[model samples]
Target: MRSNHSASRVVWTLTLCTSLALLGDSTLYAVLPSYHPAVGIGVVQVGWLLSMNRLVRPPLNMLSGWLSQRLGPRTPYIVGLSIGALSTIGYSLCRGFWPLLAMRALWGVAWALLAVSAYGLMLDVTVESTRGRLAGIYTSISYFGGALGAMGGGFLVDALGFSPAMFILGALSIGASLLALTLPRTQHLPARHVAPGVSLAWRPRLQAWAHALRRLDARLWLVLALSFAHRFLFAGVFYSTFGLYLQQTLGESLHVGAAVIGVASFTGTVLFLRNVVSVLVGPGLGYLSDVLGERSRVLLLGEVLGVAALACLALADSLWISAAGVLLAAMAYGIVPPMLVSWMGDLTRTGARGTIVGGYQTMGDLGSGVGPLVAYALAAAWGLSAVYGLGAALCALTVPLILLVRSRAAGRAPLAVADHGAHGA
Candidate 1:
């Protein structure tokens, strides 16, 4: 019963952290585009501003992980949440794009600190067998918060105006900050150092990070590549431009676009229920991978299915059709987190998990940052449909790369496979 209660608390803590992390992203989407048009920025330029938020994540993530290792995860987590809460309120005071962009960059730093610390904590508390499922739950809570923030922000913006909406988001973030304070304090192990009295230079950390990256098996790199492409396409087109697309292509109002996206996010959160299924099935899948020796094939198959879903979005003509496509994409999207993170855990030593995962997330942030610019350029040249088509194609390409990795790892023992299968994988 004690153990069960502890598990429950961990789950709640992770959920709350994820929700807080997502709030800024959700509210930014809600407030930015409408404000942009009101202030005379064109549709394309707005995409750039959205991309700016993601741009700050990679570097900050690298720093946050090191800081967490030194300071303990909870401090940075609390500080990040506080910053996010304050920044959300700051958005309302901004008069133009530059100020808003600056605020978003700062928000990205907060997101990185909180997200890296939260994930590190999640990993610390969870066992290997259950990792996949917990990742699903974490992501689900994130999307759910996104859905609520988007929906609530939209309604609030329509009813109360942008300033009030920002204030409300700020208040919610502060609430999350309060909740963050209750998280169990993590005990840090003694640091493993390379040399005594190495000054506070990032060079050693950067080199260590590079070595970790190099240590990633070719198959893992492929998975990372696929993840990169997936993020690039999604961030660039769907996330960055979807609102503008609805406005220009569908003749929808800003409120309507936010509603559609919010509803889509809610739909995506619903799909995360499958993570509960993933928790049940994830171990089975890991066991099956151990049994059949075809983990890569399973991953490839999932990626292929995701590609098809992206293609469906590309072909979608109506809003309903596009939404259906999103649902399909969500299904595929939901499957990857558990399997991929678990696989990474399988590959790395216990000591390096935080650093390695932080690096992977940094790469993800890099992909996310690049995605928007790429999509914006593509959209400027071709069309929105073309962007979707490219995303679909990229998803398809990842399958073969995943296959290559699977084939390579097939002969190796599953060293990292957990005994009881903790939920952090």
Candidate 2:
């Protein structure tokens, strides 16, 4: 058994590690669409490169979960961090569509290993009483790396060009991997069975997967749906297209007095602002959900805010108005993720939680993966505003589903956050 203080340290360390690992990935999001041609890719290939890692994450998520269950989080976490650093290095050196695509896919594998292990480890060490706050803490600190990555990466790219910027960040990522060596070798002891004569038993390779699938109930299904919808719009479409949209609306460079801001620099600043808001609100909103004793309510409000933000962003022709939309969107991004993960914590136990979290993340990955492809294709056909409008509509459609989950929870006996019964699925 772990003490709260020890668990808290673990959560913080894991979060910080992930934050560093994310430097390359988030920086790419900030610079890629605009710099696509600089890296030997056409405009049409931009979305594919942006989303390739995500597209490969679904299966990798499952693999990460199973590995976490069998070997504990420490090993995979270290390995993932190493891979992430290598992939960043690859990004710095590689050119052309195929090479960049391969690096993106490699990053996907890294994320799967890091994310599932972190979530599983958090659950293993913390209780219901501490889960929400720790989750909030995890989210808050995790985005610090993203915030820096976007802002610094843009400045670096603008000042030193793409390869140098990436190489510098990749070196930093290697430092993060070294930091992981201090973590305990085994966080969650793998469950084992021993019997007098039961050596004759047989277990299939995918038995864990089958069991995880069988465990999904209506509430779990709702979690998956919410994860899918939220990521599709927020991380997927919005992240992939926001730079292009900015270029279209604001032009290649913005001249404010003596200062000239290129599209990548401006995009990075906006992205940095968005992530700063996420860092600021992630913990507070998570604590709010804990205080309210209902993650669903907080999530519902965030979803609605997402709808409004998208609409605002779609129509805003002025800078301040667009900033407002970005602010709202940031709040939505911060609020939804921790609450959704905590809600999953509410509905699951340690035994099945790893696989279940994997499933949830896989759905999110699938949505994010498909989102960039769809958004780019649609934006080309119908214009960026229409694509934003479509995102708003999709966000709006998720509201009723969240309400249903809230109502169902209200009508039934509240599921205990730390319930270890066989009810988990």
Candidate 3:
């Protein structure tokens, strides 16, 4: 067995490596507008390019889980980074929609593989009690990298032009692939086997999937629903269109707008005060949920705060107001993922953890895919402000859904007892 220090180092290294690999994704948004105009595609087509990447996640995530079980997580993780590097290089040469779309799809598959594998490895390495804090650390680093990637790509595109900027992204991805090879080999240990004659056959796969759906434990479902909507709106409206909107509506230079949003988001995520708050206060909230036995309450608090932040953004008349909204939203947004992941860990058995987490991630991607399309449609009909308002409303809906989940879970055990007593009598 590895020492705790060794395990922690491995987890952090993997997290950082994953973050670097994902930097390519951030650069895509920066480079696409420039590339699209050169290739005669409308701005709306860029949204399709973004969403299409997510369209692959649901099925690809399922495949990733099975492959990880069979080949070990590290193997697939390395493979993913390699493929991602190649895809990034290919992206530098693309001139048309079809080539770009194909490269993005390849990148999506690589993302699914690396994400599922790396998360599984992280869970395996860390103690359950420390999972939330570790998750926060992981997410914070990832977002920090994203901010840098976005800003750097924008600057590079402005100075060096699109193809050369893409070449730099490809080079970074290749470096990340090299780093992935150094990850510890613990994942190669064989998983504990199921009993003989017990097979995860097609029928069982379908049955397990059905049971997972039906018994979806209301709390887990609520988290899924909230994450889906939250990410969808954030990605589709805020991430996908915010730069374009600022450029078009506010007449800000694209490079300046992208850099400002990137810097603000980065600064918000890296706040030492926020990290201290998450470390000190997040666990107290988590422990309270454990004691009260109500995960939904914590989730509701986070979502409500998020909705308020979104509303603030919607009403903001200046860049400063938008920056403030992002800071507030980041605090709440930063809290939810770790809390939800910890809750899932608490509710699941060790054997099923990988599959469940993979499913959860896939659903988040699905939401992300839908969000952009919906925002685009709404923007076309009404306006960009309408898109932000709708995001706030969707976030607000999560509050009630969380309460419903809590109620259902609370009643489940008592209802089981009543049924048993009636059968005995």
Candidate 4:
């Protein structure tokens, strides 16, 4: 029991570290587009600068996973946080395309390290009983960091200028790095022998990932597909286009039966409220899964909500109705992430956990990275409403996948899949 308490404390501490490391990244998003001139860049450069981090993450995530497997989570986690701190500081010091571009790529490296290590650490300290709840806790706290950074960083820049605000954020990131020192220097790895076809190199090989893929059965495959779809639609397509969607459908200002509200304000509020709902609901949903001893049921609820939300957005004409749809969308996405991640943990063992997480992150990044470009292209051919309807249809498609995974689980000796094909080390 005492060990459980200590482990829980460690999870909480790691969660805080993740939140602090996110400050500069989230702040940059809020600050860059509006203050391009102050940062010594053109409006054209803003999109590239913002996207460079995610564009660089796929390979880095694989590498981060390999590192977590080789060196344990502590060293790499601290290194990532230190790199993030330096990158945050560089944001204040560097200017122009080349220099800031390098910083953004370097931050990408840091995030890859941070994400995988934190995920690996969570797996290290948790059991099947505790995984869902702790995953929720991590998601809730980490999101709070992003929300704080987006809002607080903008406020700081307004009050103290960009350079000072960045410097302060860098200092906070350093503080988070310091906290990581409290974690164990080396975590226990469950398997003594490397899984077949997996390499020991710093850089992940395609064959290695291919081997990992071959090992996952249909259930895990569905989880990975859902991860991609979730990010593609919510993070990539919807967020990038929603503001424009509002402008097109409702005009620059939302008319609430004679009450006037700026579209920009309305968009920001809805998005921020979406984050707020995630922070509030993330843990509760995770806890519910833990109590029920099943994550797919909760995941199903989220998917249904997503379909309903997107359908509402596609058809609704009123402001309040749109807001309701946004809220539903928020709950939908908020529920999926923690539940899915925890579900993955439940279905995999510790030795191969990092690699599995790496694949999940890679898919998510690809989805988000590719989503907007494809969405806009599709929208041009079709329309925003049609694109949204397509998204709803795509979301609904996941329901069958979930039921398939659940049915597969039912056909086995309950733990057979988790213990052997899917969860084996």
Candidate 5:
């Protein structure tokens, strides 16, 4: 993204690209849990497949941060997208467990590069005060696109065969990559590094962060901790296990292609509906966060609702009850991120945006990795329901931390001033 581009253009372009990428990838992700087991992979091993991205994310995140400075966000964005396209194609043809695992790992690298570049691009196009609103818009598109993508992929898989469905999804990524070529160049992110904003040596950079972390205030630390836990529940437990749970709940399993698709497709539709809630509610939440300037209250509410969502999932007696839970969870998911990122934006500096966002994402990555591995082990020892119960407890524990965010004078005093100042008519 060229920093000089119109915000509208950046928003639409980025949103569209994000949608395409997720739409393509979610198809594969939505199916893979059951698909893997059908092909003879073990349940514990499925956790590894779901989480292969985490293996490369920590280091790659740092590298992408540094790399984006030198090469510009556009270069990595395009290259990473190209790889995403190829990876989807790889999934279509690869049959061996090891090869598929490697592809999943490669997708992780692509994701790291894409996320660092994309989020940095977001920071470039907006001011600190405007972050909540913009972050909400971005998150809305991300979730909305994800919803459409997963739903589309599910139906396609249901109608066509798996390989054919993958081919179609792969093509979507290719199309998105081509569309990315038309993106306007960014001035904040120049084509090549004119200044040394980032260190090339990883060790020195790592050491620098080690020293720099001591200066953070209590609230920032709390945000990071919450990020880790929230993502843990999201990536590790919910996503990795949800499909399997559905299968178990419905008494469906591997090799029964149509029956399996019926169950998976239903879950995909539920996810689609949840994302729709995100799309509908996201803008309003973003606006609320900006007006209140007190992101903590909004964030805390989201956490509380998250606990409730988990409870619904854990103790669900019927699909309707689970759907209600999903709606609650989705709304909470929609609500918190804009406030979280906006709140974090307030705490950090523009110069440190790259590192802060990178670190923040890495925290989520850590949660995602740990959440699933532990969930898989626990579920194996216990059952799927245990994972949701634990998730609810952890989410409950984080509400207090979110409560500690000190609201800005702008947040506490008068929102009308903020309404005009942050978003001009």
Candidate 6:
């Protein structure tokens, strides 16, 4: 599969974009939790700020997906990369309460635009035979990028200054944008390309939305449900709670928190891996997913290990314990996402590729936004410990849901139309 030249080009370019974008994006989480107190805000406000960045994604994803085939992956890919570069620069230059919040809100849109386009493009290059390995490779690249960004962002702030670090990262992102232009011009063709008379008026967009909604099947809903739960626990409750645990409970400083957060938090590649097992073992694990031919089983095995690891992380009072937990969890966490993406690719049609990925991401984003708020609420009511405990439960809950999901059904031949009159499928 690595011998496939076109797929190789896709991976490297996509990997470069993921690395550079994450390098810039990682700067925010590097400082945000500890910086919150410096700015005279509290836990709840911090969660709100974090959630604000995720809140706008669902609708934007839908719109981006709807428009993807029309504009082609190339256009959005360029636009998204540009926005990512600018937004990191925005984080560096902005301050004050409302201004900062507004900036975060805007970054949310930039993130969705960039991510949906990347996912759409990744899928564009391969069919089902290559899907599992490609998905694994793509995710592996993202994880590796995230680790570099997390470590680099912290080291940069320490070596130079916040603004300087951001500027460097933003410039890298811009370079990746340029690299995107070099992607092979001949690739996946749109099932329906944009015509001259195409219009994005509200009526048509709304109709498309309604038509798409009616097309949703039991399998997609199950995947979305699994996606939602995965993010809600991992992204929301676990993230907000863990930062408080490290800072207040462990009495660590910002730098310590940044290093450890990536290890403990389930959310983004914001995780900086001191856990060497994941890095060393990543390719093998990815290969296992491809070889097994049963993604849900591999996914479930990882989830089980991840949930157990999260519990250990919650109670870890020493660095070694924390490292151990992170190592175990990383092994599992690394497997699940790529498997899920592969599964979705197996489920989707050529025409609805972007829309399906968009919906998948949209649900994940919703969980990301709502998860933190829910964690905050749980923390407020039960205590910070409860958030991790409940989050573990949520992770466990998804395994059953994964089992409930029927194996991926591909092509239009097997799919029954939900509303033939509306979509004319």
TM-scores, one per candidate: 0.76, 0.83, 0.76, 0.91, 0.78, 0.78
Give the per-residue lDDT digits (tens) of candidate 3, residues 26-82. Answer: 777656766678645678888777666678878988778667655656777888888
Score residue 385 of candidate 4 by CA lDDT.
Answer: 89
As for lDDT, the candidate ahead, 1 or 6, is 6
Q: List the residue pairs that clash in candidate 4.
A: none
Off by over 4 Å in 2: 1-3, 27-50, 89-103, 153-168, 184-215, 255-260, 411-425
- Misplaced by over 4 Å in model 6 are 1-3, 32-51, 91-103, 185-215, 246-271, 274-283, 310-324, 407-425
Top-scoring candidate (TM-score): 4
Candidate 4 lands at a TM-score of 0.91
Clash totals, every prediction: 12, 1, 0, 0, 5, 3
The lDDT for every candidate, in the order shown, is 0.65, 0.81, 0.67, 0.84, 0.71, 0.66
Error of 5 at 178 (Å): 3.3
RMSD of 4: 4.2
Query: What digit string (tens of lDDT, one per residue) describes model 2 on residues 254-323?
Result: 8989999899778867877788888888888887887787778888888988999999988888988788
- List, residue by residue over 233-309, the lDDT tens digit for candidate 6: 66556545655665554454334544644333432332445224445454455567667755567778778877876
Model 4: number of backbone collisions = 0
Model 3 global lDDT (CA atoms, 0 to 1): 0.67
Stretches of candidate 3 exceeding 4 Å from the true structure: 1-4, 35-49, 93-96, 157-165, 185-204, 244-298, 317-323, 382-387, 407-425
Report residue 421 deviation for candidate 5 (angstroms): 18
- Candidate 4 has an lDDT of 0.84
Q: Which ten residues in a row have the lowest lDDT in candidate 6?
A: 416-425
lDDT of 3 at 402: 73
Query: Lowest-lDDT window of 10 residues in candidate 3?
Result: 416-425
| lDDT score for residue 166 of model 2 | 95
lDDT of 3 at 362: 83
Per-residue error at 213 for model 2, in Å? 3.8
lDDT of 6 at 92: 67
**Which RMSD values do the candidates have, in order?**
5.8, 4.6, 7.9, 4.2, 5.9, 6.5
